[model samples]
Target chain A: MTEYAGPLPTPTIDTAPFWEHCRKHELRMQKCLDCGHVRYPASVICPKCYSENSEWASMSGKGTIYSWVVFHQAYGAFFAGIVPYAVAIVELAEGPRMLTNIIACPLDEIDIGMPVEVAFEDITAEFALPKFRPLGKP
Target chain B: MGSLGDKYAIVGVGHTKLGKVPGVSSIGFNVLAIKAALEDAGLTREDVDGVLVKYPTSGFSSLFSGKLCQALGITNKLMAVIDLAGATIGTMVQYAAMAIDAGLATTVVCSYGDNPLTGPPGTYGRVNSDDAAFGFVGAPAGYAMAARRHMKEYGTTSEQLGAIAVAFRKHASMNRNAQMQKPITLEDHQRSRWVVEPFHLLDCCLVSDGGAAVVVTSAERAKTLNKKPVYVMGWGQAHPAWDIAQRESLTVTGAKRSGEMAFKMAGVSPKDIDLAEIYDCFTYTALVTLEDYGFCKKGEGGSFVQNGRIELGGELPCNTAGGLLSESGMPGMLLLVEAVRQLRGECGPRQVNNAEIAIASSQGGILTTHATLILRR
Candidate 1:
């Protein structure tokens, strides 16, 4: 197992639920009750309707690549072993985008609009990060 | 609203010798840059009744402006600190103008200084985020994603992106104060190592240690100052989104709105401006801003930068002082200083010919915050 040495998420009140869901290997996002809009990074109030009424909805775990980058250099000591890895922003089918790693695909093969599904990687004893791998691909 | 009515002008501009200075403390650079700007305006510290200081990446104090004012022994009625990241400088100018307009103060001094080279290697401790865990480390990665999207959407090519670095280096070669004075060919940019995909090392701004400051006062008062007044024809700022993932569109920026407001306020269009001092943390930043600021049709930034159009003496010369890429990376305020200097006919070798009106646009965060300013002689 590759040690996840990068920074860990410190769950604030607004973001704790999102991480808690990830620990259970569930892709969850905040959906506004007022405007039926989905938001990310887990905010308290709805960005669309400014309503405080919101609920957590389990995601379909399906999305497409919007954009991506391959790190040629390690930005920190923990990430030194993971040079040349791809970091991508995945646009969920529900219209919210989240940052994740595109796994199970060769670095040279990743392309915009590639379909991917959520896969949980146990980074820490208490937390499992939701990463992505190409759907229906080994 | 009506061309700012000659209401405020940048009376003076000053910059500390940009690049690494071994022992200068962060605040140490601030004091030096502020003193130099005060000297350029031929006024003592006492003449400044308002102060604004851009928060440094390190050693950012909540009372930054107050501390600077205290160091100079000047009592300022309006003192503020802004943390717009790279866009702080341009925003400082906008807010300072507002302060004078509202009678909070008369002469406002906005200053920024930092020693990032002496700070941590990447400028801060590791950023804690889910994205950071995935090696989405810093500005380069975020910008690379944006560039990749631009390429996929608009067919922008690496050659077109490299043209920005080559042109800015050509301009920087003529600027004695520029950090990278050696001119680079397009081949040099193409061959440079990749910091992140779609962005070569040459495409990024320099990580330097230096300071910059500017003095803003009413045009009536500025005309009596020692230096020629560079009038603030108009200014506007917009922050459509803070996070990169949340932005409505990667290809557009808040500049779409901010630039429109600024041009309307300046009573000028992109065609009327003679030059642009755009924020170029990365070459793509300048390219995208040019598009959003109405310099070119959307998605044509790649083509607009081709064939030396952005080089010195080219039509609508940009980043005439080499910008952050080849110039010092004191963030975006230095662009304002360069715009003022260019309007004053002070840049000896890199001066834009007959430069009457100039625009300085800045982007902060991951193409998040934006500010636009129009200046005229």
Candidate 2:
């Protein structure tokens, strides 16, 4: 495929590991050493206990749909032709919410508290976005 | 007996033509707004010791306020650009009063200017953020998600959200100066094209080119001003400072704590507020704020907004100048300006009768920050 025209994440020193995990199709979050609070998007310090000591813990990639919206308006060039995309805030079982698209499902069928699991969509050879799909659906 | 309550007052308010201005750059509107507000206050730039501006949202530069002051050929003892998004306007008044109390400056000008409507095509549509990578890059999407959550949690219907649009549009219809003069019905809101699901075109605010400013001075000094000074009885701010996905509840907002602090400072409660100029960036934003501000219980804003409860002449009239829904979408500064006007009884047809007390709310960055202000006639 040519270069992916949609938006892409620029990994920082902190978030590089998280993005790398995504490329490898592994879900991991930073859990504080002191407080055991898990966080997303890769942070240096624990927001709960201010602990700089933390480790990347593998996640189960399962969650519930806290909420969702189907955006009809294209906000950028990449979305100009293909809008009406549904975006959801999926609250992972690990207790952190992720902003992602719900795929492999009908838009009208999406609902709050619906069980879901991570499904990776590889945009480029080395990059993948972790979307979600209805639980137990092949 | 709050130390800051009733110590300062807004002496003047000014704004540019709403919706469409052909050639005015962002800073050009700031210059125009400050001059008009100064003239309205019967004062000149020389009398102003403080200048706090919320710069154009479309773009930003370090020392933007410095550039604005240089354009106006004025020097001030206190100057900075506040960047709380829509909440900056109400928070500016609080900061101005603090500066005055601390003897840093006596009289202050708080203003905002933007040209998103007329400046460059797709200016309002373009949203650059980390979330863009995942296919969400617009304001409406975030609010629509929150609105969707509110619906699922509280049985809030699309019609309930329509009440907000219908009410503010009705108020705007009565306001000749509003950008949208025609009143819309619930059916119109339902029929409007979807910007995002759970949000029609009516659910979103106008993209406007505008500049708005207000002059605040010591209450004692306001006694000498030309207009009937609207006293700044109370001011408070709250910023949860978390991303929407990280929030504890989508329906609850920073306005909850912000309003509590302001009402506590003003020695009043939500029921004491005769008129409220809430920042209605969208209909759901205002509805939830009405709940968070304690006007009604949590999860009850849907019913509370129905039955003519939030329109003009209703109990606890809100956004009588049409608000961002129908008025110019100048962020929230215009809401503060309108609140002052209503308190002064200057709103020709849409004024809240016997409006002795009013509360103006400003929420910034998709309900991430909030500021509440209580004023007295």
Candidate 3:
């Protein structure tokens, strides 16, 4: 078990849906209605066409290991024991990249373009962090 | 429009001591620098009607801003915090100009402060995200990766990278305020421990705790300032793809877009620049910025920095105060201060002779956001 003590992000009215989906172990992205562009950050207007109309769509929660680093230092007192953990940016198949941590895999084995799938770790009673694990060898 | 060539002077500039002052809080540093800037400009706190603040990790807190305002005895003014990551200093300048142009404020103080090097534990920790696996531990490694890619593509040698460190070290020897004044040699740089492969310990920048502030007023108001006003000729900013993989090309940065816009706005060519204070978080940073800023062609930065082209007294003198590589690193804010100092002819031994035009460029994040400013005497 890991401990987290930093301030938790409050899901405002605009961002509640995204957080709710994470709680349910689902990846959601905002899809623009005007130009059919998918956006990672939930926004009121489409970045491409500036349209206010948008919809939330579920994603496969699959992406490639775009880039990552193993932090030797702990982020906070709560994570002091978890030194030397790997964090990474995953490029979703839908074209949005997410900042996430890679787990259940050896650090040395992580590389660019490695296939990964999202896994939820319920940290607090209300929040579940989205981590990733390597896809099993076929 | 006024001729872009005309000067747009910097009325005031201020810098806090560069080191671990544990007793001083972040807001304390901001107020200290701002007060110095106000006095340097020979104005009262009430004279400042606009304010712009930028913090490293998070945006400014209203409580912090209010504390500084009360300490400085300032009340009732137009203000906004600019949170553009590394380009905060330049963006602050742009916002101040907008305020002046809009008649909302007369004198605007743009300031930045941080104490990461000596603050509470985990002060420099990475943001909570999943991207830590590739050992993207910190800014140094992120820049090291860029250096490695540059080497793989352009045959940029480690020796050439050392030249940047060595040159900046030489420049620091002449700057009393520079944090690291001891001279460094290529041998010393090569022998330094490896923070990340292809980037020796010397290749990384110092993580110092400090703050920097600059004051901008209308051209008319600047005429009465105590010090010579170094004009803000032009400024521009650009955001490349947020993710490193999404970049069109890693070696080339969006600095080109910002540089081109700044140059166009100032109506000056790269050759017109008498001096430059480009951000050098790593050796390759300056190399890539040189190409991106149009000083040299793309893919030519490796060779361009070789043979002391960027050294003091070179055709294009750079980082005359040793930059972040050798001097104190204040998150690229010091680069702007050095540019202002050089244009004002305040730099004694390391000053560029007859330096009438100067340009400064800074990038925040992993080359994701870039900002450039053109200055003139």
Instruction: Spell out the clash pairs found in candidate 2.
Output: none
True contacts kept of each: 0.74, 0.77, 0.07
- The DockQ value obtained for model 2 is 0.77
Candidate 2 residue lDDT tens string, B232-340: 8877899977888888888999999898889888999888899999999999999999999899989999999999999887998999989999998888888888899
Q: Which runs in model 3 stand beyond 4 Å of their true positions?
A: A1-138, B1-7, B56-60, B121-123, B132-136, B196-198, B245-248
* lDDT by residue for model 3 (B175-199), tens: 8888899999899999987665567
Q: How does chain B of model 1 score on TM-score?
A: 0.97
Q: DockQ (Cα-based) per candidate?
A: 0.74, 0.77, 0.14
Candidate 1 scores an fnat of 0.74
Ranking by lDDT: 2, 1, 3
Give TM per candidate.
0.97, 0.98, 0.79
Off by over 4 Å in 1: A1-4, B1-5, B120-125
Query: Which runs in model 2 stand beyond 4 Å of their true positions?
Result: B120-128
lDDT of 1 by residue, B200-293 (tens): 8988999789888999999999989999999988888988765787677899988889999999888899999999999999989999999999
**Chain A TM-score by candidate, in order:** 0.93, 0.94, 0.89
In model 3, how well does chain A match by TM-score? 0.89
Model 2 chain A: ten consecutive residues of lowest lDDT: A75-84
User: What's the lDDT of the predicted structure labeled candidate 2?
Assistant: 0.89
Worst 10 residues of 3 chain B by lDDT: B128-137
